[model samples]
Target chain A: MKKSGSAGEPRPLSLEEIAKTKGSTESETWELRLYVAGQTPRSVTAFANLKKICEEHLAGRYNIEVVDLVKHPQLAAGDQILAIPTLVRKLPQPLRKIVGDLRDTERALVGLQLRPTGTEVRE
Target chain B: MCLPNLGAESRMTKAVKNKSQEKRSLPKSLTGIQGLDEITGGGFPRGRPTLVCGSAGAGKTLLAMEFLVRGAMDYGEPGVFMAFEETAPELTQNARSLGFDLDELVKEKKIAIDFVRIERSEIDETGDYDLEGLFIRLGAAIDVIGAQRVVLDTIENLFAGLQNQGILRAELRRLFRWLKDRGVTAVITAERGEGALTRHGLEEYVSDCVILLDHRVTDQVSTRRLRVVKYRGTAHGTNEYPFLIDEDGFSVLPVTSLGLQHEVSEERISSGIPRLDTMLGGEGFYRGTTILISGTAGTGKTSMSAHFVDAACRRGERCLYFSFEESQGQLIRNMRSIGLNLDQWVKKNLLQFHSSRATFYGLEMHLAIIHKIVQEFQPKIVVLDPIGSLIQAGNKRDAHTMLIRLIDFLKQRQVTAFLTNLTSGGDALEKTDVDISSIVDSWLFVRDIELGGERNRALYVLKSRGTAHSNQLREFLLTPHGVDLLDVYVGPEGVLTGSSRLSQEEREKAADLIRQQEAERKDRELGRKREALEARISALRKEFEVEQAEAQAADGEEKKRERALAESRTAMARSRKADAADTRKVLKKR
Candidate 1:
């Protein structure tokens, strides 16, 4: 889903969406930020897994931003990140966090609230 | 994996090299916490991680925070606090009560706090992940302040936040090594586990130093104790020391640090009562000596302590009076009745009263408070009114040990300590519940001598070390003026006191008067007998004088009769001639 902007340039679009949403209008844009530490294997896998999930479920309404904490460690304090490869749902009310490589798709879906909890999402 | 192993190898070599270079002892980082440095033989090992493990509410976080705050404020060492349990704002607020302005310190760029919020419910683990984010945050915080000290308070929260224990444990080991590689002295706090030093056995990784803090409640009183379990490459105090957390922050009382090598002062101080002073070697208690005044209730223990404090204050010496039984107002008012204006001394700041219930805190807390106040006030004299009250706060052995430490502390400072003990009525007067009698320099026993339907107080110096003291018991009196020690009546009936002594003195006075009257009567009778004998001898001499006069008159008459007969016979001229010759011869002889 590349509706808002490219994944590499999601900050400005998300800021604009947040400012607009402060008014009475609610936006349908899904803003997701993934926190990682450098180019580790888990970070790469989590990014790949997240991209696949977003393209499959929220095809045209999602934006993915990758925050490498090694380069910008101060950004970790914003989302209270302790584990690497933490996926934070920045927008879409009730912020959620999913940690790890996101290798298990069903669990990731349940964590991000894309699928209801306790539902067995078989392939 | 290869890179991490190489890093570990390099760190191991560096540690070895460091050990070789400093073969004597590990370089230390001064915690600046009072009494902690002394117990640690300096402080925590430098550039190494020290695990401070304790149960919940045992002051682990405060201790670690103080380490950082003191490091920044006092030692000029910038520190970074990576808190896993408390937020930065919470820590700052909590430290504010201890007089540490953490926010100000942070504004000065001397301290940096990073809270690693780990909520297990919010995060779902899908696959393998390392705590690289936490490492990055901590490193960034450390680099921002160029910190020489770091604190990871309760870093074990990662276990709950992450699913893989293998990764978390490995990462923690690496983190400790990394902290060492960064050459920053670090304090890591952990929760105590069952039969283990920490809940996660974090002590296994950070092995340079491990301190165990315990908060134990005995008899409904809680005491906080700290013990240095292991300090590698250096000797440390092995005893469980009592620590206090108050407005001044954390202070560990290194009780046994004082040895018996205190300099003894030969100077003597008054016991307040002049007679009592005279009883104690004609001077008073030796300066720097511990004096125990043990007595039953109402035997004037507090009154005696008040007199001591009064005397010390009158001498212009600062006196610290710790009254465990009475409040400050009550003590002052009561001393006023004894004609001692303690309020004046208090107003002049020469006397300070620290009154509290004996059960208000554990014995250790009381000891710590005593230590703190003694250090701050620097009093020349310390008075613990009825120290036996403290025995109720702790076991007899604990109270004994605390008293020994206290006595040693006071003796080292050459502070004359006056300790009053309340002996129960049934127990022997010579026995003290705390069993601190042996170490005391002087022991004064006051007891209630019940006799002749009256209860009276008597005092005697049981023992006075290095000074000759009175062995006789004196009747203790709490008069309107002050304490008075009167000589108890020691007669055929044993030691008598109070009104009985007064009555006995009166009875002895009457007996003395009767004895004087009997002697006067006997002297009068002997004078009369001498006068009668003199009269009888004079009468006898008068009778002998009358008899001599009668004999002389009879001889004269006989001579006249003889002359008349001779004249009648007159014719005989021969008789006349013979008489004339005889008369002439007799006249010549006369």
Candidate 2:
């Protein structure tokens, strides 16, 4: 997993690394970052739901970076996280973000652009 | 509240912001505010941030909201209102009162209201931060609505919520540039500072237009005034103009509109009275000119004004009468006594009256209201019964300036204006409260000429620019038909009027009668002498004729006797025959 240590500090990733994760002559890998204040109930549910969706749909090709803002509060500025428990899709580029507890799975998937609308979720 | 250094970051972002800002070329976005559009010469600079600063309850929020709402509704440019101090529902409810259906606009995606709620107690500054979250939210809202106008109402609330002043300033500057880069015209409302324009001195950052709104109370009358402090790359009115927040929203009145470049006309309109017309060079006042009728108390000033209006209405021209001293009914009734039937004109809708107390508002507000009504009514002539009452509403200087502007405005529209002023407490005709004689193109003074224990109304043209007017004081008369002017009787004792003229006339008549009687007596004596001379001459002629006839008879008798003696002597001598022949001739002639 690739991580930014705190806000305003971006660790640049090599082009080849991004290319490989975004499926250059290989299976597509998803790079996701989840921001949270602490391991609260809502935050836990968001993380669990996100993991379940990824396991059922993108198992063995996904990486999750969990940023606990309580421990590293300065990291909030980097992603412009006004609210807690925000999920960011870093790979398959054109980075997208969604802010909520991720309770509504279908809406979250559609907002995150993981699946097209009116389609079955892959198992 | 220590602030982190954001110099380098701001510089870098500013470069990018300007690069994007250069790509767009839209110049200005119309605010759609009445008179404000004229003042700004269109509106705020487009795709740039404009600063609107004012004190609390000074209509800052209302101005900003109107900009957005009017832009969206009138100009078809969708807008987003980012309210920092008020909630979304509160804003929606507030806007509803202004006839702006914010909820419907939001539902149609024509407008988006984002309540940027920042609780001071909840937010803590841990380290360096940028307002990227706000930018993202704003960008998202704009993208959703495709807004062309944006308003950040009372952005100073961020100064309290955010603890970092340095970063906040940098971010704000960046945000403004960012809005410009996004190509959306933005209005940022800020709280007025003690001395500076904005609390945070946002004017330094906002380089396009800066408007200042002020609400001041003087003599228990609160007036809202607006002034454009700075407008880059454009000319705007710099004077303080009075504004109002009414049901339709905030309307800023650019009182004078700054210049005196109005068009002039040479067409003339009648002065209502034929004699008065004759006094005015037989052409009356210019079409787009201003006239001043100044007089003392009970000098028939109102009557003259009514005559002017009645004549205008008779000519099928619309007229407006703004009465400050009397109500509409009272004025109509008063005019009726002088044979001016104004009710018929009112019924025909060619004449309208707007009566109000001069103390109803401040002078600027009064000017604004007048301007607004004039625009709506579009009358050919406007009459202010006593413009002096307006002087009581404000200072002399302001009233004078207001008068000049009013005259300039009317002249620009080519509407002839007649303003009546009461010359207070003075014998001469120069006791005007506001010296507006210089602005008026024509001035007619009506005065009371008291002579022989009777006051008489006299009218004269004081000055008529661009025309030669009669320099005579005519005896002004108000007959049942209308106002009339009689030639002032100028006998040996100077100008006479009223009872003095009548008495002078009576004295002249008596003198004329005495002169006539003396001339008739002398004519009779001369006729008697002519008769006596004729009688004597006739008697002398008769006596001479009788004497001549007697002399001829006596000569005839002598000749006859001589002829008899000659006849007797003829017996003795033949020589007597010749004498006897002469005697015979004389006797034959007798």
Candidate 3:
């Protein structure tokens, strides 16, 4: 839950807004905020894995925002991030949070409520 | 349904396995709640979840908060309080009133408060949701502070926030297991269900211990009680114990532990009044004994209490007087009239007066307040003037139970306590509700003896354990000097008291004077008769002497005549012989 949002105050850029600013199309854009504390190995691995999953499934519509909580710790409460390596989906109708490194691609995808391209037939 | 995540499942299995290993006997974590440790044998089971279910306003939240606060402050165990119903600030404010400085504790990192703001309208529960967010938050908070204790206050508030019950229940069970796996003692408060211990049957999951708090009202008096429903692998007290939530926090009086195992003292103390002390055997009451002074109104019960307090104070021992009927000033003034100057004792800091209306709180609260005050003041003697006022606040059974517990507590501490109870109506000496005569070691009954058309106070030692007390009744007199008990005079008209004794003494004095006066008059008359008889005898003797003298004179005169006659004969003879011997006669005449 986003507890507070100061209207006139400067805030960190979301991945979708950054993507739109980068001249990406506005149709069905995926926005995600990956919270990390410093440049730890687990955080690095989580970011790499999240990028790989987005590049493979959503090449043109995906965006990822890396928020280093060590530098901006106050932003953790805004996204309700408790764990060190957490990925919050901000653009989706229903916000979803996944804790820990995204080592298991299937579980991370399922936790973030993102379906693979051919998952319909698999189900 | 095939579960996609094995990580959480494996963690749950590991927790369950560890808990089963501890099923033989659970270790304890002392709750630091008064009298609760005695009942639970220690406290709640450690490193496991204890469910606290109670109705609204039943003090469930306060109990949980106290558990956390006491653990952090007293035991050096850091705690995390996860409030699902109240915000952090609100909780801090509420706890501040109870003297739990949550803000300072939070700042010191001894305890962490995380308010879980989950509004129902703001959340959308899609398919396949879990409480992993909550787990992460709790785990992070615990790890940050290295908390050994965790309190989830009012977990039922989640039901209002979350949409799905099945998922919530399953996730909650997993959460409790996780908390146990984390090896932190957890207390989960829940709203009481209609027919179950908790609304969602949460007791089945958090089954190590379950405590139920109830605030019930009877006859317009509300009493808060706590009961331990179950404590797995440990023996616990099953009776319902009354608890109080006040500024000092929660205190539960273990009703079942009030056994007669307290140590007795051979040391004797005076009952304040020397006469009263003589009535109670030769010495007085036992030093640590509970004394019950029962009487009707205006029978000098409070006055008797004041005397005991005064005696304790005079001994340089600290005393506490709990006046439920009179204010402190009024009590000091009233006692001054009876010659007990408690004000000086107060000034010397040897005596304290706690005056409050009896109806100010319930019986349990009153007991808790007394316990707190006694602990703080550490008085050597305690006087609860007219404990009967407590009976007016609640049921008779509750008052009786409270008295028994209070007396037990005092005796356990080796404190001399004097409780005065006003016996209502009649003179049968019937045991009233506030009558603790059975439990006390000494029972002094002050009665108003209505004789001689006036009411006179009388005191008698009805029962004094371990001492041979006097059986005679004494007329209790409350004079300006002090309390003095006069031996009741046994007369032909039964016990003489008041003006009748005075009148009877006066009558006896008058009768004695009359008898003494008549005897003196008779003695005087006898003396006058004896003096007159002696004078008459003396006069008779004088008269006899005079008569004897007259007789003697007559005899002398006769003798003289005889001599003269003899002389004449001799002269005649001499004359006759003179012729012959005129010269010889003249020589003889010469």
Best by DockQ: 1
Relative to the real complex, the DockQ score for model 1 comes to: 0.42
Q: What is the lDDT of residue B548 in candidate 1?
A: 93
lDDT of 3 by residue, B1-590 (tens): 11122233334334433554464656789999887876676788899999998999999889999999999999999999998888888999999989999999999999999887554433333333445556767777888899999999877877887666887788788888898899999999998888987888765456688999999986677889999899887766677778888788989876435555568788999988888778777898899888888888899888888888888988999999999999999999999997778999999999999998888888887887898889899998999988888887887777876887788788888899898887878645757555456667788888888876899988888888989899988988889998888977787768887787778878879999999999999999999999999999999999999999999999999989967865775687677765546544654674
* Candidate 1 C-alpha lDDT tens digits along B1-90: 222432443344344445535658688999999988877877889999999999999999999999999999999999999888887889
Across A1-54, the per-residue lDDT of candidate 3 in tens digits comes to 453222224233455654453343236788888878778787788888889888
Q: Candidate 1: which stretches are off by over 4 Å? A: A1-34, A40-64, A89-94, A109-123, B1-23, B560-571, B574-590
Each model's chain A TM-score: 0.74, 0.73, 0.73
- The sequence of per-residue lDDT tens digits that candidate 2 reaches over residues B90-137 is 998888887788888888787888776554432333323456557766
Q: Whole-model lDDT for model 3 versus the true structure?
A: 0.79
Error of 1 at B291 (Å): 1.2
User: Whose TM-score is higher: candidate 1's or candidate 2's?
Assistant: 1
Candidate No. with top lDDT:
1
Candidate 1 clashes between residue pairs 3 or more apart in a chain or in different chains: none
Binned by DockQ into CAPRI classes (incorrect, acceptable, medium, high), candidate 2 is: incorrect
Q: Worst 10-residue stretch by lDDT in candidate 2 chain B?
A: B1-10
**lDDT, residue B163, candidate 2:** 67
Which candidate do you rate higher for TM-score, 2 or 3? Answer: 3
Error of model 3, residue B299, in angstroms: 2.2
